[model samples]
Target chain A: MGLIPRTIHDIDTPAAVVDLDLVRRNIQALQTYLDGTPVHIRPHVKTHKTPQIALMQIAAGAPGVTSAKVGEAEAMVAGGVHDVLIANQVVGPAKISRLCALAQNARITVAVDDARNVQDLSAAAVAAGVTIGVVVEIEVGMKRCGVAAGAPAVTLAQTVAAAPGLDLVGLMGYEGHTVAIEDHAERAAAARGALGRVIETKALCEAAGLNIREVTGGGTNTFDITSKIDGWTELQCGTYATMDAGFRPHSGHMFESAFWILASVISRPATDRVVLDAGRKAVSFEPGGTPIIEDPSGLEIESLSEEHAKVSLTSQNPDLQPGQKVRITPWHGCTTFNLHDTVYVVQDDEVVDVWSIAGRGKFT
Target chain B: MGLIPRTIHDIDTPAAVVDLDLVRRNIQALQTYLDGTPVHIRPHVKTHKTPQIALMQIAAGAPGVTSAKVGEAEAMVAGGVHDVLIANQVVGPAKISRLCALAQNARITVAVDDARNVQDLSAAAVAAGVTIGVVVEIEVGMKRCGVAAGAPAVTLAQTVAAAPGLDLVGLMGYEGHTVAIEDHAERAAAARGALGRVIETKALCEAAGLNIREVTGGGTNTFDITSKIDGWTELQCGTYATMDAGFRPHSGHMFESAFWILASVISRPATDRVVLDAGRKAVSFEPGGTPIIEDPSGLEIESLSEEHAKVSLTSQNPDLQPGQKVRITPWHGCTTFNLHDTVYVVQDDEVVDVWSIAGRGKFT
Candidate 1:
């Protein structure tokens, strides 16, 4: 049997390729780390945005899944996944209505840091005659969302406790801002510092006699550090299952390279420079850079446009032909995955499955 | 009735807001600029990727439409667009098959810079029993794609002519590298210099007795400059309809603010800063910056994360509290539009229509 069922030329260039064995191994490793720990694994679905991946994670002992948008949660529920947490606040009537509707089938929880949002959630849940779980988001150094560590977070938790149609589930804080620190020691130190604040806030909530069933936070980069937090009931890591070039430097675990963009060199008119078929439209630009060329020794991707990538070779490699195929390991796999509609799941180089990112383009 | 619809709040937060009046005016202005010229208009659909917007451009006197992917062409065809140009090269079996299938129904044209691509196109066309229109892409200023300008381009044109199942329709070149120059006079001067090389290649092809009917190039930033080129026959401008924050400084015509991200302030623990509900997931970061705050009083967007946007407010505006709504104009409208599934079309305070970005997530 062929190691790769399809040759590089057989598949379309600029397509998102996922190594199935790597994804399975990543899941197994993460599960192994959390073994005998109280922390439940609730992997974030926002990374893959595919229900198939969510089911796989659940099968590997994940308690549930988390999504960034209500539309994504709804899609996951429709795909037969029962539990989902909209880890961000859902504002406006349209999104609130959708959230209420989603609660009819699945266990839906949302994070809120402000009291006004509590009112909105309560009203929406009351109108729908369904109770929605609300998690008080405490600021954990991201400085992006959530209330400050102590009194402010306690006030929000109190409001959630008093809200008629809302259930005060627990306290949640995301140390996302410190996840991708280039220095491994510094990243782990910052993760502990940030999660420590959330632990303090959880203590305050417990003192107020609040029922804190779950405390969730953590991303792919800080999953190892977050697993050691005393009060964190769940780790919400997403990008671990599909390792990217950007995460490799910060990740503490042995994450297999799972995602690659297959592209072909379309132009090689100059001796030093070449161009590929994939560019900003095919991949993403979050890391403010282009993908690393997997072949062509000493070549570096210099720049990218909407439909083409320019690669400059430092030394001559006779095997680097004009039409040769190469795989690009993107810097950020989550954003790159969001750019595509379908991903080919390959096991042992054969495309075992073609899964749709069904919840993609649900930004609203 | 209010000029701006009230349904804006009900539609969805972080939704794309397009000003129809502004879009119509932009189309009319571009059409007026090319009034007495022989150059035809073929707006690139990769920017909008919506059939409704493509139809509007065609109705505004565009000769045809252009796209970067076969999936985009297929979506446009389903939306009733007949003349479509896949302005990028299609490689590998899957994409070539789709490109050939698109040619079965529409007047399909594609860019070819490689001799092997010509053979691939010919094989696909012959297999489908269709004649695909081929354009010899010439490198002007953007080093990303296209064969080199003089004899190399002529050689590719000759190859296209010799191909049995392809027609040598025209030539295409994109000076995208120079489009973002902040200085107006310098931008026009740079565009003229680069396009001069492209025009020279066209002349060489003509002297060799090749039938070069249409010569297309230019994006929204350089539409006016490229339209004035003597040998250029068509303009492929796409971003004119929905001008982005980045293009505002370059565009001569004032297209009303069409797109905005409506985000609610979710946290305001500090008097100097506030966090918004919309973050990196809802916006495009390809421009390598945060969204421009629509408020005129100098509220700076500090930073962005996966689900939060930190805004720094002026000391004078300390009263800006949590739960208040704010509008954010993204740096790149094209990528932002692709991030969402449905965009609301509003008129006089109501949602007049909802258009699905059908070609979204078609990265393969």
Candidate 2:
């Protein structure tokens, strides 16, 4: 290519620009925080969705990468990641076949809460002649997707252990409802209370003649608390690598925000208002946490259409005109990263490289 | 090479499925409504983002397609459409160059609200030796992007007329603020009042000796009111082809909802709770209008995680179990279509064809 833009100004507008230094710092910070603990780091690939960054996280002491879908796990394997843990349910015949196909090349582990789903996984694994690891997900408090954390969890683990071509690896329970509590002591108490059932379930499974080797839990918001809970073997923190506005209020001191959406001011309709080219489609409008302009001047995003952000200037005469560039911090990094196909890697405001978000739109 | 799935049961989960018969009927309904009136339809392709669907709308009776970005316009031109309108501001040098490149083989028109952008467009048009059409977008009431609707619009029209290699084609102003008012009389009154400024600006431009031939406004919610209003030439009602839950409250009886997200029940955590494979990533979670399950048997979406929709059964046990499929209607079709790469075209629940969402991520 013809000399890819060396500086951020030469790059196109509405582009996902990533700070490489901050990304490395964020990864290093998480690894450093869990250095003295027994918990291993298995960074979630859902936030960045780029395989290169997953590799970087793996290089920085992450045991493997955690994916939210089977398609994401497949992409990680194709990009040279040896071990993958799909942290969600992989349902239906097509996805089960796809999940089984990935086990032929590398270590593929999936979380399941239903006995029927576990049976289907066993059948697919036997048909494909490959072994797939199973992690029984326990419903701690999130109440989204997990079996109840008691005899139910123990029974599922027993069924997984009895299935053919399947290896019962561990137990998983995410304290999602208590992750972003915003108070350190309150968050600690909530995490401990939610994860107590997980520890109990692990003990129950072990007491029933089962070897539960791992117990995984933790979000980026509660990684510090969950890492110290004595039983969680790994922290599946995804947004730590690319901090967002939503989670930054609670975890700002630990990890630096590295991702930004670079947009151009396209319309200065009035003296007090200037509209940017980025809107809900470019950034995300997550509830209770909308994106903000990085200038920190008296500028505020009033509303968003499909393709434009109507920003009002609280300061008098900001000198913003058409074609002027501004950086925006997205509310939710995972959803915002899903909107773009590529991100420009930057260091010190200079373009370093370009990476494709290979795992985006991998909903199936 | 292999036989495609003939029925919806064989298709993959978390897929965007479009009913071809409903889509054509919606298109025909809108076309029939505007037949006796003098207003022509220029459907916005931002909702579906498929070139094949845009071609279908053109076949029904559309002079051109309206796009929200330059990249979408480029895709339309490459997909055998000769007339395209970039309905939003296209800033920066790279996009301007790309817009001019498309004018080499098609009639390219764009909306502008700033003089600096007009100068840049004129310079780029001259450099590329192509004439571009310009539409001065007036700020009716949306407060997003456009010039003030009186003398300011007239002045911008003058500047556009003086700019070489640019043709002052028409005037555009979207009454987005009042389109979904939910009351027929109130919507009609609001549409008339907002579009009144557009007609006034056109008259003022004509008084100033500018050939303002076209005046465009209206969303799908106020298409009927806008078509009956005097001095309007076209309507840009996009969601009429694929009605969404957000706009269906006001316009449901006129157009049928044509899109559905087919997802599999992946988790049955409790007797009253069943989680689907589709979540915010598969469907949209737009504020004030989140998606709903198509089954009317007392099913409700409680919350959404990244990859799972926590749905609750309002009544006693509804027979939804793991591996069973359900259809979902999205809150907003435009944002929902942006998440998929391809849509499976279905007719009577049979797979008829597959069309790529060619303009899904054309933010620039």
Candidate 3:
């Protein structure tokens, strides 16, 4: 099912390219994984930052969508995703008020690690005359968020349960540190250790007279490992839907690479070196560097400027010309997706679907 | 003239905070520098990526605005900046056609280093029934774009002169490598050496019976050094309008810091460590790293994550608490502007203006 547009050469280079067939297949595979498991999937929208992809996950039987910011959650709601969870803390009156207002239209939940944040969120929800779900974030190993796993996490859960206008909704912990780990066995072991802490924290919360029902955690990297976590009820995997080249090496779950940055070779000054039109400005450098060049036999990307990428080749590939276009699969798909406003869903070579990153650039 | 909406705590954290008073003063300072010089100011719009900033530059007597992409130029045109130049190469049929269409509404010019690109641009402009201005880029040590200094550049200029429906405007070179050099004398020497090559290239073009009028180049770091180049007539400074914390140590100019990413402390688990809401997603890591913490009492940003920044204070800052908000001046102002949809232009503590980063996320 390739569209193969007649004017393929007319497309701009460094544009976010998506293979629709691959994306659909990726979605189908993730769906199959969740179907066999008891874990409910609530894919993180922060990965794609697009309502179209979020809806696709929902269509594939996701319970809801997860976002890192209240603005993104609000945008997802506006774009027709009914259930949204801010998987991070919601602080300040502006954001808390926004999150509470969003609950008026859709199901809105937020993660909390500290007592002050819960108090602020409760006051804001009370002011807005709405009750918001709050998930106690348990610190596993990431050390970025949440309180200490056992006692401190239970204490925070108690605070959330005792807070006014706040519904304590289970537990949440992000083992993001294990997402990009290379070794399968080691990654699985680390995931088990981290998720074990989350499970223990949930047990402590239950012993402290709190009813825990929905324990949500896990990313695309640890979906398999976390699927077997004893108490985890929901998987927050998002990147599996639009797999990048970096994930190909680690993911035992085979997912076709759907994301590609179409860039043109603008300069070939020396026979050994060529420059692409796309650079840090187009694709992000969030995953430490630029995309790995897919084709052009002997070339290696050396460095990136704002508008150009310097590539050195051992020998020039006969297929590559100065003006020829090539597709680049970025190291981190999530960050690259956020950098573009629109992503073209392509098959073969033609563009069949145009999807706006509805929540793109919503950092606030 | 300060809006002072309420207090610093009243506004949301992790928002793009701009001091309009500082921005105006910076603009005036740049205007003052170019008062007696023959150099034409064409402020680069890639930094702010906003039409309001471009309009302000025009109001300060800038002849035109420069953009790194065709989409940016289009946004400026829509925002009412009629004179625009795509300071980077415009390759492939889609971008060329778009550039030609943009030329139909505004004065559009682009930089070129190859003969084939010149032909492609000419063909697009001819098909669109418009004439496009072309600037022949010379190699000036950055090695990113441009042909060799003298004869090669002259030959490219000749090709541009011969091309149909294209006007050879001038010569341009970017000494990006020398921009951020910490040593003042060494930086000036490097700028002189690089601009010397550009001057020699212009003489070669003159000898080849080509009239080269405009010679444009210089970033925020090298503006002063390159301003003294003999043949250069345009200063294309972008970041000066919104000085970042990263450039403050080396700016050598009295531009006030205008941009700050306001973020709240989300976590305070340890007595010494505090985590902020802003992280890699909000600010770019290109120039060096994330924004430095601008807390009143001495504070240092140790590390950052996707959603949290682990900030360690040298001593306890009485002002900073778990829920207290702080301001972060990013390392690179340009990419940080692209990460958000709207920037709150603040005076004192009040949001005096809110401008959409209209051209943001236009990676394609």
Candidate 1 chain B weakest ten by summed lDDT: B1-10
Model 2 per-residue lDDT tens digits across residues B273-364: 88899988889887787797885346778898778898877556477888888889999999999999889999888898988899988888
Measured over the true interface residues after superposition, the C-alpha RMSD of each candidate is 2.4, 1.0, 2.1
What is every candidate's C-alpha DockQ against the true complex, given to 2 decimals?
Answer: 0.51, 0.81, 0.53
CA shift of B294, model 1, Å: 2.3
DockQ score of the complex predicted as candidate 1:
0.51
Candidate 2 positional error at B267, Å:
0.6
Model 2, A61-88: lDDT tens digits are 9889999998889888988899999999
The lDDT ranking, best first, is 2, 3, 1
Per-model TM values vs. the true structure: 0.93, 0.98, 0.94
Error of 3 at B221 (Å): 1.7
**Deviation from native of the Cα of residue A268 in model 2, angstroms:** 0.4
Q: Tell me how far the alpha carbon of residue B335 in candidate 2 is from the true structure, in angstroms, after superposition.
A: 0.4
Q: For model 2, what is the error of residue A293's alpha carbon versus the real structure, in angstroms, after optimal superposition?
A: 1.0
| Candidates by TM-score, descending order | 2, 3, 1
Query: In model 3, how many backbone clashes occur?
Result: 6
Runs in model 3 deviating more than 4 A are A1-10, A126-129, A287-289, B1-9, B313-315
CA error at residue B71 for candidate 3, angstroms: 1.4
Give the whole-model CA lDDT for all candidates, comma-separated: 0.80, 0.89, 0.81
Would candidate 3 be rated incorrect, acceptable, medium or high by CAPRI criteria?
medium
